[model samples]
Target: MVSFLSCATQTHSLKPRAIITSALPYANGEIHLGHVASTYLPADVTTRFLKMNGVEAYYVCASDDFGTPILIQAEKEKKTPQEYVAHWNKRDYDDFTAFDICFDFFYRTSSPENIQFVRYVFEKLKQNGHIYETEIIQFYCKNDQKFLPDRYVVGVCPYCKAVDQYSDLCEKCGRVPEEIENPKCAICGQPPTKEKTTHYFFRLKNFGDQLTKWLEENEHLQKDVKKYVQNWISSGLIDWDITRDITWGVPIPGDESKVFYGWFDNHLAYISTVMKFLGDKGIDGREFWNSADIYHFIGKDIVYHHYLFLPAMRLGINQEYKLPDYIPTRGHLTLQSKKISKSRNWYIGLRDFLSHYPADYLRYYLVSINPYSQDDLNFDWDDFATRINSELIANVGNLVNRALGFTKKTFGTIPEPDDLDEKDKDAEMKIKTLLSEMTPLMEQNHLDRALKKVMEFSIYFNQYFQHKEPWKKGPGTNSCVYLSVNAVHAIALALSPFLPQSAQKIWVQLGMPGKTTDHPWSAISEIAIQPGHVLGEIAPIFVRVEDADIKARKEELGTK
Candidate 1:
């Protein structure tokens, strides 16, 4: 008797569990399309694909409720910081819901749970000798009778000599301020007095060599991201500032008068988000936090915080806590070759975009351009309209409408093919090949290429259907109908990750029993649509966008 055991056929570097976190946008403003395009949308797409592939994945982000921006915005609006954050939190949450961003826990960072974790992590940092005392000269305005936050002061950037830049970072050159030159208070138009304040500093130099080694070792980081991190290491990472003289944030452990810097406390929210999600079910978040396959999808502006400061803090807190497996830091999402600016009213709100178009349409178009892989992509409305109308509607949606609509209206059920041709076999093979090819690209975050490949197949499927002319009653008409319907099924399954809403609608129209997303992702090309399957209700999956609507949007955004 043979006693050989079966070995599994799958190879995996990824574990069973996944956690995705987009960078928390500050609570001072509404969710804009650029934010959604760069971080949230791609993260949502990745989470959808991971879930579809049966990985236990969760997407989380919190409104960055603590920080200079919130306080400054509160003062400008003549409201308390807490009141301001509450209003914007609800607004942003509602906007995300409208845009169909399926976050597991889109909570606020200013919570009791986050405060506890901040304290705990700080204690560990102190114990591990990473925390130290320091004194900093921060800006103070006597008229306001308070220390000015980052956004309340304006100066020419010391690094790039750019005038009228915020004191925290340079807008033109992307430099974090070491010391501002010729600073003045913008709030009261007063020259600020420098006030000395005691602050906590993290001794990052101790971990410099370790961070360098790890950054060099991480293969999953984007090429430019890795280079940027390495350059940071080459420039000599200094002790990081971990305290701010403000009352709106988590206070330092010993002194209630002092608060942790927003950057420090904000990163802790990533952990708090996971903990909150797990805590709802009476589970400790530490177990998963200690070893889960973690990914951070953040904008390029905050690369220093996540790559250097965060991992060092995590290491200081616990050696067992898993280091980041992937950090897909995305560049800016621009409009007409300029960065999106809400201050200038030069960006679209997620709500405004949703009112004009379907959420999935934006999702598809964004992934097609894929702002992450390049420096940036312009959010051209003409491109948006043309891609959706020509590629999505005319090709993919058209294939489903013609194939399934004709089958249901004419035959009432899927017809068994009298004979399969070489073209049918080739189409089936191409579907299977796409399934294999797309998995690697998705795994590597090559979502743009994967999306392009799917559209390529959709174009081929439409051409095949047009060549066959399945509507006319003639010899092999039933066979043509059969092949066309199955090809539609193949396209729907393959597109489930990229355009889930349209995929589900098409799944129903194909007479499938459940949601398209519920089917196994690996079964996309492997499973065949059986003959005689009755069609479900037919409905339009996508609608054509008129040139007038896009023109109106351009005019509203002040674009030429």
Candidate 2:
């Protein structure tokens, strides 16, 4: 079994520290469901699970504040880049918190610490013969009178032939083209002219052999993602242009006219932010980072950056920082069978979703549908309501309410189980077995599968409750109540990582003293709730997701 325990055990062979990071949300816009589905939520869940299992895991993220998109948006809004990013940074963190993404330190890429670190890394790479300056012809907009960088220029992807892609990244094919084809100024909507300028480049091609060896040796990375990464390596690596003609980014050490590219500085924030947090506590962040297990959670769209640019930079700097041990990559979330486009108003904002529904409802539904792979997942309103109503409310919620509600009304406390009957013994054994089955799945980052296993356990107990018919006051009534309530306790622990708020509600409903996460994950396997333990207030943990509300939401999106 590929259990988290097993992974932890191996890491514990050295130390039990872990650092989890989600892809930084660009500070130019509000976070939408698509943003969380593939990265933030999964990272949060994994971090929570690791903490529950006694791992010293810290989840950190920063707002990507130095991209061309931010600069353009700031200019259009008539606000300085700092003021613009400040507003969205707070706003994005608030939205993420609303969705229960518990980031330990939410910093920004534009912070002084990151700027200094970026410059430090640049100097180190320069000394190590990995940084060089070269003159190249860059797109310069005649109308805008500025050199276009990244989001400022739009063109067809040279490799994939996808139209209207950013010059730096092609979202359609997830490749970073060496140069875009038929480039135009995004601001003026006219073909851009070329101008020669000297810019700094990272010797990404130099680390090709090292990266291939790392990709082949790191078994923790997804096989599917590794396959493509290896293929990209085989196709001849290209040196990355590390400097951009922008004023809002980390300044190149001696050159104030140009700054480090957003990708160059943004990812280094991962290290700078964590080090800032640890430095305040008198901890050696470098020692800790090098020793801990690291995970970088990202969507498939940025695979080229995370897989190539990120590791290669670390390797170039004499491995001052270690590369991520696991990159949990997932596919984009499409809405209603179409691409979710912010410009088209075809997306659901995280805050907007929470206004109409509980966070756990969204959390549960997203994780239940999302698999541990790059295969795209669709979020249809009809499908969302069906899963919440039939699966969450009907299956898991039904079992919890039925079990706890009956126990509160009839016994006013947990009843002593009668001597173990065959069925009772089987149910008890199943709870233990389910935890064993789920451990490896969670460890393997198969959160979708692990959550489904928990739901299936709920189904099994619901059936067991139906078969025993505790309402009939039969001879097995006390035993059924006893086992069922214990099952609710187990379910809450199992569900804690996915549906945390709902799990806490279950913990309170069961009259448990502390948070569900306060108990070790292994406690789920035991019948920890004893007889004579008075039940807390018994109320339904989840309300059925109404079709009318869902319909209104769909209509708001201009869908029929």
Candidate 3:
């Protein structure tokens, strides 16, 4: 039995600053809509929101370039692994750009800086007596000149009888992996030979008691996450295999032949990428890394890795090397309730989606279906048309365009406001109160709920404008227009985090120079548009997503 000690640490500071990271995508495949919706987009949203609130938040992610799957794909194309990764790296960057994922620096794991940091941590683990070498039998593929790791070998699952099950687990049925009955190399399509090799292993079992104490004390985790982590810790722990016989990865600190496991080095890229990003900005990176507030946005598939392996790696290197503060995870993104299968070619690529619709259209839809719980989300083109047309075009777009269009046409600009009436005051109070209530939800990582509140404000303002008939010239008509104009201004401020392009359009239409991000979140409650301000050219920001386009897309995807 392991002896337990208190692992409680200080909480995050009250300041608005944060260091955010998303799950790293592997370099072997095209990044799909599901990936952006779950990982990178959420982090980008958080970073944007934090900066809007005057927070010094930083976000960094890279392409995971190691492991057997990468090598297998490269071999099939008769290209070097490095060439394959570099080719797809450009594609990933382009895809993210098309969707407006403004990462600080979208680097790759093949960089010298990443190798440097991985080696540093490896050395620390070695000196701290947190790593041990062990001889174990692993499946060897002679043609590939490397031992096959998990996700590279296949066998029959005894419990679920699922063929082509991966090592250490059955993904389809979640069976605890057992010894292989029929072993085959996933790449070469041949029987793999078993060979005994010496490899370094991280002493993950050593940190279990400390992890349990720390996890219980850490208040930032989702309640379900904490419960699952605690149950996992209570069950048991295992020493993790942290190195392998591979040539295309970060080498062990002192040995040049052995490579660090993808599990070990992949997560370190989060730290290494941050170091490279901040260090280039002429800022000391450690000041942020040492802080207690660090958040990771990942899909639920990697929960074991992030909650178990990552924290242990940090504690192995140094106690003060802050463990993660909050880990917000989401379920899988499915296409019409089916898993996205690359082999089947049944998924929509980011490029394909952007061809038919604008980036914000997808952004709004994805956030609406964001998996706050463990339930999966299906990307249905029909539903996408409905929401964009109804909630966005019919509601948000109509309101902004009508209010700004009337202002530009009627007064040639905004007019001086009269004294406030009871209804006008009440409308102002509602928007202010809702915006105030949303701040906490965003801070707590409940972005889905906070977004719902923001949309509620949009509808409230729409009704208020309609009830007063602000376009008609009459007594108190100027005050009605003033309230409607200020309401649109407030909506733009609240939207900067979610739909930045639309928000900036609203800002420029209001004749505000620069971008919407220049305005802070606190500005949403204050009256921004003064009377007699010359409004700029007004146009609709969002177009209605048509049913015909969605039907064509569904046909393209081989759906109804």
State every prediction's TM-score relative to the real structure: 0.94, 0.97, 0.93
What tens-digit string does per-residue lDDT give for candidate 2 at 1-560? 01233222222222378999999999988899999999999999998888777777889999999867778788899999999999999999999988989888899998999999999999999999999999999999989899999888899998889999998899988888899999889988999999999999998988889999999899899998999889988999999998898788898988998988989999999999999988987989999999999999999999999999999889988798999999999999999999998989899999989999999999998999999999999999999999999999999999999999999999998888888789999998987787788888888899999999999999999999999999999888899999999999999999999998999999999999978877777777888889899989988888887778887898899431
Residue 538 C-alpha lDDT in model 1: 90
Estimate, for each residue in 1-560, the C-alpha lDDT of model 3 and write its tens digit. 01111122212333545788889888988889889877888788877777776667777778999876787779889999999999888899889878988777778888899989889998889899998888989889887666888777888876567888887667654433546558788777788889998889888889888898888898878778778777767767778888877778898877788888888898888888888888987977877787626889998777878888899999988754578887888878999878888778889988888887888898888987885665678888788889889998888888888888888898887788778789888987975676578788777877778778878888887888888886677677788778788888888878787888888888888888877776667777777788878888998898877777877787887441
Could you tell me the TM-score of candidate 3? 0.93
> Which candidate wins on lDDT?
2
> What shift in Å separates residue 159 of candidate 1 from its native position after superposition?
3.5
Ranked by lDDT, the better of candidates 1 and 2 is 2
Higher-ranked by TM-score: 1 or 3: 1
Q: Give lDDT per model, in order.
A: 0.80, 0.90, 0.80
